[model samples]
Target: MVLNELGARINTALQALSREAVIDERAVDALLREICGALLESDVNVRLVHTLRQNVKKRVDLDELAASSNKRKVVQSAVFDELCRLVDPGVQPWKPQRGKQNVVMFVGLQGSGKTTSCTKLAAYYKRKGLKVGLVCADTFRAGAFDQLKQNASRAHIPYYGSYTEPDPVRIAVDGVAQFRASKFDLIIVDTSGRHKQEAELFAEMEQIAAAIKPHNTIFVMDGTIGQAADAQARAFKQSADIGSIIITKMDGHAKGGGAISAVAATGSPIEFIGTGEHIHDLDAFSARSFVSKMLGLGDIGGLVETVKDMQLEKNEDMMKNLAKGVFTLKDMRDQLQSILKMGPLSKIMGMVPGMSPEMMQGFDADESTRRLRSYMCVFDSMTEAELNSDGKPFENESRLRRVARGSGVRPVEIQALLHQHRQFGQLVKKMGGPKGMLGKMNPAMMQQMAKNPAAAANPANMLKQMGGMGGMQKMIQQMGGMSGVQNMMKQMMGGGGGGGGMQEMMAQMMGGGGGGMQNMMAQMMGGRR
Candidate 1:
């Protein structure tokens, strides 16, 4: 199983605890056992897993939790924080500054994905509106420059490499100098992947590092290597000032333990994660964001930054409307259009709080996309007044049929769209009032929070004001856990409809208000059904 399965298993264990009427030491130990077993199966080092187990046990005092209003929620929050601690080295990764040359060097074992990650990193920076360049300094590997050239060309990034130059050091110096002179914001140097056993290649790595003096020397490790990544990462760190790490091939069936081990090995924070083969697959690394996404909690700030990276035009009116708790069919339609503008449905869903990769896999991306477009068609067929109005305008059966005929979709789908609109509107109304989540948040601060999670972590953050982990949890509590997430997605994805979603299961979470965030994800992912 990959990390997705690992996350699923851990979630499954926690869900078991949610069922017990009483929370105690035995139950907590059982949860820890299941969680530790999942992590161990994923190739996490036994020692680390033991440490995590002990740490969580030490933190979640059952006696204290019993007195707490929501036992499961407090325990879940503890686990989330501990998981974040496991991967985060507590060191700040370096960021490139605009209008200044920032050189980065990549080194790792052969076939560790150093070459591809270099281009992906460059593309990530390029999308941020930075002037980025790539340098191929792998003289040991045949066609290394050719690979970098092909990848760079595909990403439309400026690159430097020589077919005739036999000295990798000279090429490294010249490439950095060229890009430095050209005023590139970020220049990435891709070195030949080498193990510590390769003395000459290790020397070459040192020479290139000395020449470029890269601000960040990244060690790329393959996530599938599991616990073995520790030694490889340590070897590279000894040879170079390996400032940060990038673990590649994480989207595949990686054991996932290797990623955590690599962090422990180098004591360097992960700067980025390569999720797929595409140049756009790279994601900025944050410990909180990673753990949240892994546990099926969405990263709103991360998603906001991603859309911002696209440099799309801002719809300020939409923000004002949302702040006022106003949501109409047009708002929902606008959201669908935005989803279309985003990349793959699965990738986008992974960032959503409730949808984990495992739950997302259950969905057909093409079909979900088609469903979104179909919703747009339904809206397009509606009269401007109808689109702008509340669902009172859709009560006429004849209007529903007319839209159904116009969009060539069943009337049921149109009804489903209206149902979704109603639910979203109700949820928004609850969240946007003067006492709601966005009430105290200025539109700009909300946007900034979405782009920078650190600000969101502030005590004065919007989620805090909303009495939530993000917002959905408290809102789910406030609304008494209306169970429609599954139905909403089932209609949108075309099948797999089931019972009351998470409503019946989590309806009791808000006893005067203590709904855990996992509550919303359970609702969002339909009990992970």
Candidate 2:
């Protein structure tokens, strides 16, 4: 629902195909046709859709997929993988150590959300404990300084700009110097939204880039631009060493697919996405999750981890309740709190499988939160006996009336809550019993499940579920827990796992003994049970 129209079209296309297995070539061909039609309808680049269809056909021909019984699943997986590659070829790492005080410059036309994105990036880095500074070099806009300054103040980062300094290059140079003087770790340069055809303005951008020597140049495009993204990307790339792409206003756009495919076609990786107007609405671009969501194969893992991370203080308690198969209205309230922490419901649910932009079109975050809160109030009005003994409340109409009156909601709404609670309770019971998929999992697997419940719920486990010992260690570090296991893993893995390989490096940082490192090494070799 985050990108409603596109999401709906994609879901409809994927629904036409089965994820089990297909023996008929005709069915596979038909499925490909549907997929192509859907992508085209979503305003995806024509050439890219053709390439995707061809790749899907080629993969099917190679028989590299699952066995006959699992053909559908294999083909679906192939399609998802290919789609992800089409949008983002791979992860674009930002190496702070490789460059001196990484400077990222944001460029876009006016009203494309450049200033807001700069603020979001600053906030994101600040949350990571990095010292960040912002520069408002958009002198062409009358109020650009005040606008960016307000955002910088909100983010609590140092901002450099002068209404009197008419030269953008000088402002940029001074901003960099100021950040350097303050010992900031990251500096972001925000430029005016200039038309690509304006030679004078383009020359100014080049001068600013040269004066400051930014480590990365990001082209911020409005998702509403749709097919125009190709031209915009080409224009920016001509003037600067564009290192990354950011698509803004994604939540309101119907043609975001075009922006994504267009940038990817230009050989630039999408680094981040803006889902809404809020500073916290930006998310790191994840190709796999995007593709999976587009295909309607729920993204349970992301939802779960987001929920867990958002409710750090309540995680252990929530997990215990989950294990006990008890999901009350109170539990639902806690779940709502966790969801709120992650962001809007429609946006969060958009990550779930089968949720389309169309489905999310009219689904507002504030309205959903209001309804959920109302439902909780209705539940709270019920008597203890009515809540503890589920069947008795449902059997008595008088009790329902009492609850409706107490909560100041309609009786029908109260009944609806009861009905929903019953269904949720049943689902929890199933998840906790032996017949439940989660119940059958081992401890290590359970830990993984708990860490990324959203991933676990995904119909296609396309997104990597971050769990196991490594995930646990990361979670611990993130939650301010003990760092022992993280350090041990770093020593064992030698940090070459790249960003992930630092588990063992963390062990050395913790001053652990060599014997402890040996034990961690054993775990890496699958020696530990």
Candidate 3:
């Protein structure tokens, strides 16, 4: 949701076009004007905005699209592609090898979160099974070594830094040699940064590069720097070979269009973006996925990777039960637990088509965390028999009341928890049944589908297996289709809680009364890329 204002304006413009009864050149012009204005206001270069406008106009031919069923969708798709183009450097960033030492050098102006990003990247690679070490060569700034030492210690990553070593070039050389001798696969060298680009900083950077050759040089840029990012990035690019860029403070309320598009214009691919101060908040950057999330459109592949990273697939019992079309209370509890491990609920929930991370806007994240823990407490209060069985064991009113008392929650709250669990259980049963899409396909194929969406490009056949197209249409009609989705987004954008939307959407997908995940997905993908 970085650059949320820009996204909201563009979304509003698109929504207005969708509501229009007529589609013409004038309407198209109006849409582009609104979108272009949003980008310009978000610190994007005027020239880049102009170029995007020209590209959109070229792509969206009203005359050719006149006969199309959905003129709005055509324009929207064109705009989405152009937005992606605006931020894509079109170059692959460097990747670290697992069995060999890979030295990654970090450089940026002071206060750009360069030191923090070093730890973040190191932690990321470490999480992926790499032997990572941190080398603090940032001796120009006072307490730089201590900062790196504290961060590396906190992340449990090995570190090499010297308080007495004033020569950064020598320190960098020694650190890299030591880590390489230690057989660390990924050695991160945190170089010194200055308040501004200067001869001293450039000289130091060059000397360090000469001493300890780095495989990748990452330029860390501050998101709040606006259009100045281009000058900063270009200056650094001139001094050193910037293999990639990482934009920090994207979680703030700053307009990130400048830092993102400006750096991309420099031909330096943005490999990662720092979403928060947390070590795990550094997310791999993907132009298309970034645009999708900005527009509140989900990223299924990203969601799969998150689940995979949490190692949720290691539960053999759950897999076996799922294959047999069984979903016990224990399985639901495990999912909730896995969700907790996945970090904030809003973030993970946004991967669904209709949900946005801002759906819980103005809703305290701690409150959401507390809510999930409360449900876990209810699960813990249950006996082993209740945990292993379906909701049948909790049908007795006394049993439900007793469990609620044990968890210190209201009886109705316990019932609501049970309802949510049962819904999840039912959806899992249908999806993992012998007749279900998951059961019918192998794990490798499912993984392929997640990685390459084109594999499941034609979801009609997949939908038919779950039910029929007619069922899908009927379900969407019941939920009012995009009307319902738009309303939900409006509430979220207004900084209000939109849990009602989530519950209603999930209920429809669960087919607790009607609809199903199959029906919902096909309807959601009707106009999606």
Candidate 4:
């Protein structure tokens, strides 16, 4: 879970007042004070914080509405809306023009993830069914061409670069011409990153941009740079016509606030966010989703859709079964398959509300999947009676050995699977049951839990009161409701959930779950139990 420190603080202040039954002038003032403190702590510009506080105070002062059951919700929604408006102001979504090749040039300083981002962007467009070509024009860096070439091969996109060609401008000009002749729908030029003081290299970038004449120029920056982003953006903006910005490495540090908020301050719209190191780890930027994640409101819609597109119908059906309290080894197999479709487990987990980049960094995706797959194979060898039983039907060691032998796996793998199943079952009971647990979680606490899946299934002391199960139910319903869930399901199913096959096929491929096709079929069947 990427913590939105600034958003979390505002939500916390608002939650304090919601607990009270009566709205007093002093209570509102105190809440505003806390909000101010939180914003400052998050490194939000003092002027922005002051403006936000003034807006909040004005809303509080003008309201004659007494503290009713819904008063807290109303105020909270208002604050959330205002904060979103202040941060994003509802800019039009970015869409690369269709039916023609689009050229995108990446500009940033060294180690800002420009080369990696280029590969990722190519992968992103390739998955969209576009013929993407990569121009590794960053010839100055060691192994820059090799790195980009390797990534392009992995993504199955064409690459153009030369280790021997010392002139980057010539390489870029020729690369674009070659790709154009090949009729590629998109061409990405990965330029050499230099410090702001490198006038020679900056001039080279200008020359390359002019020669290539790219339709879009994206400025990539490390999110951890904080206020330094303003200077970097200014430098890039001055040298070239930068159309958009891509903020990389936002999964760590509190500086995501500074990078994103700085866009508004510096007068540029965010184009994309690099959430991880993988070529498939890029996501389209959405201010609403970003703000919601920051404030501890779980992105239920995003999660469901991401899952639907990446996982097989079998996988999704199995998850829906788990959601409805049905746990089976077949279901477990489907879940593992879904995880595989979703790419790395750690990456998928990071998209959840409270899971931080640090927590995800510790777990190796391949190792976890290998272990889970081994466990599933063990389960496959089980007898029907054992498979359908509530508890381990084969209680004896001899039976475990026989089952493991049949599955050609270790007996310990079976034990591990059982242990995982028990843990997961406990989690489902806590999250789904009326009074099991997760029943008392507040917005901030829920946000934290979203970041930490282990905590998501457990009850916390911070949210012990305030209407318990009923309040949780209301919160869940409000996040997206059943219709929102369905729409997300459609997105996950890719285009197959609606329209014709081509659209559906495109959606499934880009959705990221290896199971897009199967998910489409399941959705067409009405996403039933």
Candidate 5:
């Protein structure tokens, strides 16, 4: 959790409202006060916290609510929307253009994780099939070029920097020209970061900007800096045209909200957030998705996008089995392998709804990965008949004992694995079996859903179908619901995807649709534009 304390306080405040028989103005005011206090404690600027409180109060009008309306939903939506507004500055982030050389420059104060973020961004683009290169133009700091060069080498990205070049401007110009001549699609220049804002450093940044003329200048801000992020971001914006922002070291900060919302207020959309130290820890910032996850609504859209990018399109049998709502041990194995291919479980889990990065911190990714490997070993020990036995093998003590011996793993581990597999199969069967939940989807929506896994499991669509709170509770009861959902989450976590039931539902929802979830939801709600 980026701001675990704040998230917990907000959840507590909202849950209190849900417990109330009737939410009135007093309740709303109390909730806002608690939220305001949480924000202030998280180091959010006083003015910004005050604005958020006022905005939330303005949106949640007690007198305007009809007797028949669900006040909780209205209040929850208002809180969510206000949170989104708090971090969105109404600006579009810069996007790289294809078939053209895109130059991006990194600028920030020292100790802001500027140099590391530059390499991370380069690696991100490199992984996306872009011909990316890095240029180290930081002559002021000691070992600046060496650090960038080392990171670039580790990532296998082409880089240009000179230890002997005393002038940063010349190095930047030469690096850019060389990479351009080589036809690199994206060239990133890393500039010097000072201990603090200084006139000399600002002048140097301006000179570097003039020399290379970057397409985007990204100001990398340290997320742990609290309210000071605003001033630092504003200072850089003055020195250079900062087209985008990247907040780093977010995993270690409780005051991340202050840094994020403050930087957004500087009229720059946060393009990416550095969640961890790994090269792949960067996530593209989305206000709605971020806010949704913060409130436990989950980032279903992001989860689906992760699956899509995994290029599992060729897993036809898995998709077919999923469509039929038949999840076998082999299918679980396949899903686990797909998750392993995606990335670390911690990062994947953060994208899912109901599962926050904070709660996920309790489950170690390395431990999970090892557990998956152990489960696979157990799977390898089983005969083909045992693997496809559809829960029969687990009922027989002999097969379980044999698997335990052959896999060289403990019997309890094998038993636990079997138990999880059966639960997953039952849950999948409930979701996609004959007369399954996804089977009842509109033809148009299903057609569009088939293409995207995330869109298929869109929370918005689920919220619509369940008819809000009452309908949702009833539906949950019928589906063996929360327990089933928990099992699904455990299965996903075990598989290394961290999606839980939402991922399973989304996977089922794909009904094999190809268009975006928004279009599908529009058709379902008759709210299509």
Candidate 6:
């Protein structure tokens, strides 16, 4: 299992305690056992796992707890904090100063994904408004310059490399001098990777480091290598003074925990994680945020940064309407478009409280994108009044049929889309419409609020300011009480809810008319029913 699966297992163990009348020593021991098993299975160092278990046991003494303290809360907090610390090397990551030429050299073993990471890092800085350049110095690998050229072309980053340059040291020195003279703020040099840690590779790296004198030397480690990454990373660090680490291929089925913990154990801070092969897949590493999301506790800082990057002010008109509880079909279409700009739905969902990667896997981003486009097509077939109207414009069967015919879709889909729009309106109203939880939040406060468990997990507190405890109780009852809420959350968290009640609530929660997100995904995919 990967780290995600490990986290889910640990989360289940911790959540099981919520059912207990009182958390006892037995319950605590059971929780630790489950966690230990999960970490060990994910290839975490056995000694580290043992230390984690011992630390949790020492901190979670049921007998020593005060009567007023919540045993479950304290125990869970301790586990979460410890998990964060396990992957953190306690070293500051290297930062490139703005307007300064920063040459970052990449070193790793063969197939560790060092070259691609070089382009990804360059793209990352380029997107941040930096003048970035890439240098292909991997003379050892056949077609290495060609690969770097292609990647750099896609990222639109300037590059320097020579097919005839047999010496990597000369290429590294020349590329750095050229880009530095051109005033590129972030210049990245891609070094050759060997099949193993060889003397030749180290000598080459030493020569390149001396020539370029890079501001930061990053070692890219393959996440699938597990605990073996420690020895590899330490060897590279010994060779060229590695300033940071980047773990690649995290999108694969690798047990990434061992790779991460191993690298951290080598005293190198993880600077970024390559989640996918896409140029935009690089994510800045944060131990706290990563572990928080792993435990189904959302990464608010990441979400906030994505939204800010989108410049939400550009959607001011739509925001104003949403605040007033006016969610027309057009507004829904607009929101979906904005979500596309924010990146993959699975990634966005992973940043939501209680939403896990396991749950988010249900959403196919391409299909979701297609479905959103199809919804826009249906909207396009409608009259302007119908599109702008806050009322149900598709209530008439004739109008629905006409839309279906025009958009090349089934009538049922149009109906589902309209129903989803109304649910969104209802959800907005239930939360006090305009001036409610979402509308009232500034980006910074929104992140801080998500970190508070009471704010993120409790619907009652979220709605308390809107309608008080009485209204909150009434709403909870409408959703079939606390048990119903838990069931819905389980399905939402990818816990496999097959019950009719759970499905119905999930459908409603998704605001997908009568269908749930899965149904919407299927419709978008347009595959076998």
Task: Specify the highest-TM-score model's number.
Answer: 3
Better of 3 and 5 by lDDT: 3
Model 3 residue 125 CA deviation in Å: 2.0
Ranking by lDDT: 3, 5, 1, 6, 2, 4
For each candidate, the alpha-carbon lDDT, in order, equals 0.71, 0.64, 0.72, 0.63, 0.72, 0.69
- Measured on C-alpha atoms, candidate 4 has an lDDT of 0.63
Model 4, range 195-235, lDDT digits (tens) per residue? 78999999999999989898888888787776666677788
The regions of model 4 sitting more than 4 angstroms off are 4-8, 64-70, 154-156, 311-331, 350-370, 376-409, 415-529
Give the winner by lDDT: 2 or 5: 5
Model 2: weakest 10-residue lDDT segment is 508-517
lDDT of 2 by residue, 208-319 (tens): 9989888888888888787777777788888888888888888746677778765664577888889887777887777776665555544544554443334243244444
Worst 10 residues of 6 by lDDT: 520-529
Whole-model alpha-carbon lDDT for candidate 2: 0.64
Model 6 lDDT tens row, 382-415: 8878878864667788888998999997887777
In order, how many clashes per candidate? Answer: 3, 30, 0, 14, 12, 2
Please provide, for model 5 over 1-529, each residue's C-alpha lDDT reduced to its tens digit, 9 standing for 90 to 100.
4566677789889889889887998888888888888888877778877888888788878788788889888998888788777778889899899899999999887888898898888987876779999999999989988899899899899999998989999999999999999999999999999534488888989999998999999988888888777777777777789898888888746788768755555788888888887777787789887766666556656666666665555555554465467777776666666666556666766655566544565566777767767777888988887766676767888878888899888887776666666666775676564476555556664554456454544546645543455554554566555665445555555443321332333333332222222223222222110
Q: After superposition, how far is residue 315 of candidate 2 from its true place, in Å?
A: 7.3
Candidate 5, which ten residues in sequence have the lowest lDDT sum? Answer: 520-529
**TM-score of candidate 4 relative to the true fold:** 0.69
On residues 1-529, what C-alpha lDDT tens digit does candidate 1 reach at each position? 1267777888899889999888888888999999888888888878778888889888888776546468788778878888888889899998998878899999888998899999988877777789999999998889899999999998899999999999999999999999989988899999888888999999999999898899989988888887787777888888899888888888845497766778887899998887877676777889888877776766655665665553323444444455567776775666556556555655665765565564455566666567667777888998989877777777999998998999998887777667656665776676566766666666666665446433343333434555445465555545444345434443444332322211212211110011222233434343332
Backbone clashes in model 3: 0
TM-score of 3: 0.81
| Cα lDDT of model 3 by residue, 305-414, tens digit | 55556554345555556545677878777766666666554555555554544564664555656766787888899999999998897789999989999999888777
Q: Candidate 1: list runs displaced more than 4 Å.
A: 63-71, 252-254, 311-341, 356-358, 366-482, 495-529
